[model samples]
Target: MEDTNHKQSKFQRVLDFIERFGNKLPHPFLIFVYLAAIIIIISAIVASFDISVTHPGTGEEVVAKSLLSGEGLLFALETMLENFTGFAPLGLVLTMMLGIGVAQGVGLFDTAIKLTIEKAPRAVITYAIAFVAVMGNIASDAAAVIVPPLAAMVFYSLGRHPVAGIAAGFAGAVGGFTANLLIAGTDALLAGITTEAARAIDQDMLITPIDNYFFMATSVFLIVLLVGLVTEKVIEPRLGKYDPKYAEEGILAQKQEKVGRIEIKALRNSMIAALVYIGVILALIWPETSVLRGEGGVLVPSPFLSNIVPIIFVFFIVVSVTYGISAKTIKKSGDIPVFMASAVKDMAPYIVLVFAIAQFIAYFNWTNLSTIIAVNSADYLQSVNFVGLPLIIIFILVMGMLNQFITSGSAQWALMAPVFVPMFMLLDFHPAFTQLAYRIGDSSTALLTPLNPYLIMVLGFMKRYDKRSGLGSIISTMIPYTIALMVGWILLMIVWFLLDLPIGPGINIRLDG
Candidate 1:
């Protein structure tokens, strides 16, 4: 027992050190503020030194345009509002959430979750929770906030370690972040950045928002299996039997309620409505002369791929409203606007973060620093005879480390895409492949990061089961998932690469092929 306690203590000390370092960093919004200021200062210094690079596609000389200059300062002043409002992630995330908000506001998601949890077989409950948690990303903010606590309740009712359920939910939701059956705002956000970066290398290059859809859809199954195994075989067993002593506090101690008829009806109606909506979409895209397909029946560069977020928005709002009406949750038409407004209101923090991030990205592009770094990095890799698999492993590791300090997917990709995407393209890698590697890395460390906002909620769920649970406890439970996911996902990517499988329709690992 003493040896066991000592090993646990040592593991805890590592988490403590990680949390301490992470706490020293500013809020993500402020981090962007600091980054923007630093970029401007560095750009001025570099401009003074006359550093420049030749554009890879255009063959035009590019030089840093210091924000300290009068014209540069004026441009910043004039474009500040535009930067915030025109930011790609800002509008896309908001648009999708507006629809999702209606579904959540009307008790649609709550009913659906209850039905799923209660009806799942005892042996498969862990997989069910993990799978639902991963799919919940389609609803944006609601999933991260709603799933963990509910998962704890379900586990406690089943006489299992509730904390293990919380960990499972978190592992699938945040750690399996990029793996989803449906494309969400983050997909569109990252693809937009990838497109911008690829254009810098090849003027006519275009990347679809769902460029990684095939790979990610397959990943959802893997996340469910792997995370479910970890929860049942590793975490739950380690936790042993749950004590009633610990259960007498927080949410777990509250009275449990059965799923009502109204909720069941709501869920049933929602499913029917969702299928009809999907059928409509399929009917529109099935024919060779369908308007949804681009020229020559191509999927990529098609209107359907480009308009995915809006399509998701329409689906969520319409079906959720139908469910609300059937469930008697919505009595008046005015309720629809209220729910939509609630969703937008919930995104206040993201708006501020996007504002700062937009300024940083615009300034980075103006200064040409990212291009210069991409050229230099590509040159160094070439000199070392590095390309293909070894380079991919390095990119994944670098991104995994960075995820610890920067938890926002869009923000991290905003910083990385400008340099790494083009650099990989120079190595004959397609931008889709580069984005795929980055996504795998960014997701792998999400469960272990103190910087992740969702981890705070996960810790809260843990405390409901064990009042003294801390950041260290949560991190310790999650580190195994983080490591396992990185290795497993990377190996998957390697096999996919070796097999020369297309990551998406008309997209491959190599640009020229």
Candidate 2:
């Protein structure tokens, strides 16, 4: 009965999460705010009894962090606001978003997707769609905007049910988003949070966002193969082709714009430019004389790795700009401002949302919630001697399920890191292992959550091809691969833990002092 109740309670939480967010869960920033408010109200009530933790750091310290105090409350709010605004992801995200607008403004991007459909053959379309989805992040929500529509086009043109096309794209795009091998902005953001959490126990510990890049990059191929197999062997055969035989199920389709003369010219130039862009990167890394390579390797703290996101942005921007000019889609330099303005306008709501979140995080910190929880929890775990590889897997499962309701990777990490890092540190475990667990969880469950705003949008795209789909349809399809990834990932981590290999040159699970 207790087990049943436990499952039911979890289910109830999922429902509440859905109800509160409805179609849109509170933004990560705003979620931080609301959580802070809850903590404040509860702390206020708890403080009436004079309840307080003895400051665990210094034995003589008896510091009080009550949300009930007028000054205390204000300080908390201010701190959270500051932290949110200062979060590095904010700037990186905005810059990327702005850069993405250039590609969108030109008919260049839309043309590219349609052109992809014409390029790849039907049998390989499934894998191609998935691969493209992984590449789409360079364009900021381009997966949401382009993949679905492109999937429909691919399916229709090739005489397959467009719904299958839609699902193929949606699953590949989102399910694969978290697991990409290259250290993109998402890796940097999560890595920064992981580093923050890890440092709580050992001040000098460090972790790169792409610490597990080689392993993760390989996972991409497994995902593509699994998703493609499921799509081709199961989904396509079930849905049938897009011709007259499946006539009742209208695979509603549309025609793409022509390859106009100017676009044709632009296409030739852009393709050449794209090839050149890739060639230059190869040249840099291949011979020691080029820019990307540093003393040891290009993939290390090398300039190329650090600045890859910008390079990606520049590549897209230059190619798109060249296409725009050559194709006559962009007439003058003034059009650049117009594109930037439009993109920023779209981002206004997200910025406001993050602002609200920032305030809440500030409040919680001011109340000593984060630090206290982190310290005490770490102490408790140390006393119990419960930190190790096995514990990491357990938490991964918990965080993975939790991710269904709380979709933002950083938000979830921020909440858990303070508590987990300290505790794990006590057990002679480094924070990086725990963070790896978090990443695995955060990623595997991204595909299952209805709470993620993108989830529904992807589904709607599927509906354009198949009206009978739901969250279950998508989840069921990807379940096999999800299980594979979870199991395979944990197994690999266990080996690493046993080897006692250092996380990085100077980083370790426990502090030497």
- Highest lDDT: which candidate? 1
Q: Model 1, range 375-405, lDDT digits (tens) per residue? A: 8888888999988899899899999998877
TM-score of 2: 0.74
Per-prediction backbone clash count: 0, 14
CA shift at 82, candidate 1, in angstroms? Answer: 3.3
Given candidate 1, what's the lDDT at residue 339? Answer: 92
Each model's lDDT comes to: 0.82, 0.65
Per-model TM-score, in order, reads 0.92, 0.74
Candidate 1 CA-lDDT value:
0.82
